[model samples]
Target: MKKKTPGDVFDLHQKIQSELNAQEEKQRSALRRSLSETKAAFDFFTDLGHDSTTAIALTDIALANVLEE
Candidate 1:
């Protein structure tokens, strides 16, 4: 097998980093969608004459937990 050079190592590192970034972005997108759905549910509950205070608190907690992940 041919010995790898510094340039080859650098290229491999770049490829790995690029893949990581892509995966991170995908996760972020999924989190955003989840948050949006949660917000919608909160709004729906509020519009249906449900207790606003409880709904707001629950929503806040859910969002905070998801964001902490």
Candidate 2:
């Protein structure tokens, strides 16, 4: 078996950190997309004469359900 050096350990740590950062960014992107879509849906319903308060309440419920997942 090959003995690992300090440089190898550092490189492995960097790789893991990079992977974690990428995953976090992906999650943030997904959250942004969900929020944008929710806004669009809310606007569509409001344009069709839905009450703003009711729409907001429903949007909040929907977002809560989504975040719970």
Candidate 3:
């Protein structure tokens, strides 16, 4: 049986930490790209939402005016 040395353990720990850091960086970059895409789409949809709301309000006003007779 071989005895484990502190240097061996430290090297293994460092390797694992380095890999984790690299993977985390990849995830962060992907998230940023995804967020930018989503935000653009979100802005477009928000404009559509405002237009729809205005249309709906106009519809309701027209209906109310008709019923006032």
Q: Please list the C-alpha lDDT of all candidates, in the order they appear.
A: 0.87, 0.88, 0.72
Model 3 misplacement above 4 A: 46-69
Which residue pairs clash in candidate 3?
none
List, residue by residue over 1-69, the lDDT tens digit for candidate 2: 999999999999999999999999999999999889899878877887879998887778777887799
Q: How would you encode candidate 1's per-residue C-alpha lDDT over 1-69 as one tens digit per residue?
A: 999999999999999999999999999999999878888869976887779898887778767887799
Per-model TM-score, in order, reads: 0.74, 0.76, 0.58
Q: How displaced is residue 13 in candidate 2, in Å? A: 0.5
Which candidate model has the greater TM-score, 1 or 3?
A: 1
Give the C-alpha lDDT of model 1.
0.87
Model 2: residues with Cα > 4 Å off, grouped in runs: 57-69
Cα lDDT over the full model 2: 0.88
Model 1 TM-score, 2 decimals: 0.74
Top lDDT model: 2
Q: TM-score of predicted model 2?
A: 0.76
Which regions of candidate 1 fall more than 4 Å away from where they truly are? 53-69
**Cα RMSDs, all models:** 4.5, 2.9, 13.7
